[model samples]
Target: MPGYLLVFFCGVLFAAGLGLSGMTLPQKVIGFLDFAGEWDPSLALVMVGSAGVYFVFYRRIIRRAHPLFDVSFHVPTRTDIDQRLIVGAALFGIGWGLVGFCPGPALTALVSGYDKALIFFVAMVTGMYAYRTVDAIAGLRTDEGTAVDG
Candidate 1:
């Protein structure tokens, strides 16, 4: 299969999984986060299932010489916690908690015809472009360090 075709299939499968698991619903995510309210543990189970699947297959897939669609696996090698990671994580958590919509699920939720999904996605992309522009103007190599290249 062609690489783009494989990607399209994978996305469709992912969206289907999200739909089947109720992850595309913001209420489901909000329910999970509502510790003080009628707490829903179903999302936790879904997360666990997804994580377990990744745990089982991650090593197996990484052991391959190369993926069928990609020339090289672009795995991150950085392990140490840094300011960027910390800030990024905090922002992600804040966004998720405030809006109850994660990026992947948000994209899937777009088909639901909710205006908030579109708004959130637009803001997310705007933030990304804004960050890149700021980073470029700061003379910093993306994800590298504070020093400017001579």
Candidate 2:
């Protein structure tokens, strides 16, 4: 229950930060992406500020015995880039460029009852489900092939 409360509080804080930073507006994000035209550097500034904060605290947090809530920190182990990673990154970039709303801001904007945010969220969820379905099917096929060989 405490863990859930902490997570909820963090989520609220994140949403508030996004709203305060003008990140909930698709137009702002689109403006930032428009380098040839009226390019906005505010988002870049926000990114830099966030990175600075993380840089200041990330090492200290990691050096601790464990997180306050979790038993261990689940950091990513993989450092190698692959074709799948490249393709996924490209798709993510294209989606962000087209809609001007990534998952975080899109979810945050949904509270304002924006139709575009709702549509984007639905499409994003559908894409996630589609990926899971395809991955599961591929895994089953691989398992069946291994069983047949053994």
Candidate 3:
């Protein structure tokens, strides 16, 4: 319960930060990506700030005996970047470049009554479900016979 509370609080804080940083706006993100144009650099600053905080805390947390609630840190062992990973990243990049609404920002912007962000969020969720359906149909699996091991 405490871990869940902590997660909820952290999520709220992150959403608040995004709202305060104008990251909830698609125009700001698109402006940042348009380097040939005026190019808003605020998003870069936000990324750097987030990375810095994560760097400091991630190391500190890993050094502890274990996660406060979990028995062990949920770390992935897969180091190889497979085709699925590459294609997924490319798709994400293209979506972001086109709509300027990544998952986080799109979800946050839902409160702002932004039609485009709402559309993007709907599309994103649809895409996830579509991928899951296709994977299930294709019978894609790891050597362990798990539906999701990657």
- Best-to-worst lDDT order: 3, 1, 2
Backbone clash numbers for all candidates listed: 0, 0, 0
lDDT of each: 0.81, 0.80, 0.81
Report how far off residue 77 is in candidate 3 (Å). Answer: 2.7
Tell me each candidate's RMSD, in Å, in order: 4.5, 6.2, 2.9
Worst 10 residues of 3 by lDDT: 141-150
RMSD of 2: 6.2
Q: Put down candidate 2 lDDT per residue, 1-150, tens digits, no spaces.
A: 898999999889888888888788899999999999798989998788878998999899999988898998766555555554566678889999998998899778778897878888999999977865765654522222221110
The TM-score between candidate 3 and the true structure equals 0.85
User: Model 3, 9-109: lDDT tens per residue?
Assistant: 99999999998987888899999999999989999999999889989898888888889888987655566656666666788899899978888888888
Task: State, as a TM-score between 0 and 1, how close model 2 is to the true structure.
Answer: 0.85
Roughly what TM-score does model 1 have, to 2 decimal places? 0.84
Q: Would you list the rank order by TM-score, best first?
A: 3, 2, 1
Instruction: State the local distance difference test value for candidate 2.
Output: 0.80
